[model samples]
Target: MNFKEKIFSILSNKEFDNLTWNIFHDQIKNNITYKNYLQFLEINPFEIKNISEIPFLPISFFKTHRIFSSRTTDDYDIIFTSSGTTGIKSKHYVKNLNIYIDSIRNSFEFFYGPIEKFKFLGFIPTNRKDSSLIYMIKYLIQQTHKNGSHFIPYHNYKDIFSNQNDKNIFIFGLSFFLLDFIEKNNHLQQNMQKNESKNKVIIMETGGMKGKRKEIIREELHDILKKFFCVKEIHSEYGMTELLSQAYAKKNGKFQCPPWMKVYIRDPEDPFIHINNNKIGGIDIIDLSNYLSCPFISTEDLGKKINDNEFEVLGRMDFSDIRGCNLMTPHFLEC
Candidate 1:
């Protein structure tokens, strides 16, 4: 089967006026345990059913449970554990590493093919030796015949920023890290004097930002990045521990779900009733790449579903925000 057909059949047992929920349910259910999921779908396959009936496996289980199939050993690599977020502990996943890397490279080339020749300066924390950005940047740097530099400084941004050559360079940092870096070393402010008008020498941040230091507003943060990094756009990355695909946003601060993944906004109180667009509710992700694991993943994050492929991640729901963070706090840190 082709990739698209396999995804469609794996996700839906019966057709529906709304393909979103069926695909969403099928992906998550099958990921949990293929046999159990198939039986559940066969037994409960209706023309339409409320998303409420769908069980929400705890978001923390990326730590607590081994959700992926143990028998299927091929085409999967157990990636690193998440340091985790508030109220939940660290979680683990076996990533279909080849597929994961290829998708990331494809997305990067699509977005950045125009500026294939610019030097890359990464200031973010790479989660693994095989990080998506790290590996992709290496390729882009070589493809363009440019250099790649990772400014790994220990608690000093001034020294790091001072070390740069100041020609055309692309800076990619995690949101919190960038904020903290800029806040401490105000001198990097000089690099902004040079501009790459066509490619918009962007400053991008991957998702793992919320749990850290200060709470930042989207526009305010963008303004800070522009002021500090001297860049026109602040790209934001949309990725989670369990899923392989990623979505990118151009510092416009709105997360547009990639074609391979679907997002649903559910009632916070109900957390499963499919709500109307522009309504604030829980964000549930249905990822096609979760074929080896649970695909219909429901996140505790509240979001607004304005369109089929768009969502605004509005932080966590209920006491879950505080409650979830608590699960991740270290024994020493709690004191």
Candidate 2:
């Protein structure tokens, strides 16, 4: 089967190890970074039997090298840069934007039903044209085709709440913006209670306060959002620019990846060893949809495996490189 077909097939199947192994072999053969790393370790890619044996490229490599698996070229359709607090940024060169589109669309639909059913409202503060998160939200909003599906500037609470309809509304925003919106529009709680509509309201928080305000625990953040939004629970999105596929959290902070993606926790002290499930360790992600780019990425974030398919982001490692998505200057853009 071809790459896309294999990805589709794996998305529906429970047997992931065999499929993962096949993709790993193919990736090691085609991906220069992976191949070179294996060569450096004197380990033949073909001889590797298990998915766990496959070496993951350090996430930091993206900051230095132009990481890609197929077709070495500077030409790219779109380049997504990591939101680093520092001036330096990690660049992900996307050969085909369609692959990213498929990954986002398919994964989102798998987790949240259909894209056309909900109205997407983005509350991102940055105006960076190259942000992957912004690009994803924009694409989803376009697909929704709903009247109110658009980016909600910090001051524009009236525009979103002014309209009264039964249309399902999904507000995707950074943590800080959502909080700011709640604090500013304290009357929204009463408005939501008055609108006795059957519409499903979802407030999906993409993690990070962006260094705009002091950081708070996820529980406190979600509690405040739940009280203000009059929603049962707060949802979240777990993703990074380095990865094409995303994991979603319906409630709490536990994230579940799409079938094509899997997370493995490796010992922080010993990178080669895989830790037991539910044990906190370094996050190593294998995204089969990242065929053009490197598939195996060792992220600096610390997390623990919930099962074979689920995990939770604990926090970032100490003294790790600051990611662009997590920290944003408050004055530059409103919630």
Per-residue alpha-carbon lDDT of model 2 for 151-241, expressed as tens digits?
8887866646566674688989999888888788786678777653555789899978877778898999999888877788889898999
Candidate 1 stretches with Cα past 4 Å from truth are 1-58, 69-76, 85-88, 110-118, 126-169, 194-199, 208-212, 320-335
Best by TM-score: 2
Candidate 1, residue 106: Cα displacement in angstroms equals 2.8
- Model 2 Cα shift for residue 113 (angstroms): 1.0
lDDT per residue as tens, model 1, 1-335? 11434443333323322444545544544454433433443544353366435544445555555566444434456554554455645444554555555555555554555545556666666555535445554545455554444554426443323425444466667777777777767654555454333233667776546478777767787888777756677888777666666667765767775445667776655543568889987777766555456656677677797676567876656754333333321232110
User: In model 2, which regions exceed 4 Å deviation?
Assistant: 11-15, 159-161, 196-198, 319-335
Q: What is candidate 2's CA lDDT for residue 11?
A: 42
Model 1, 298: alpha-carbon shift in Å?
A: 0.4
lDDT of 2 at 103: 90
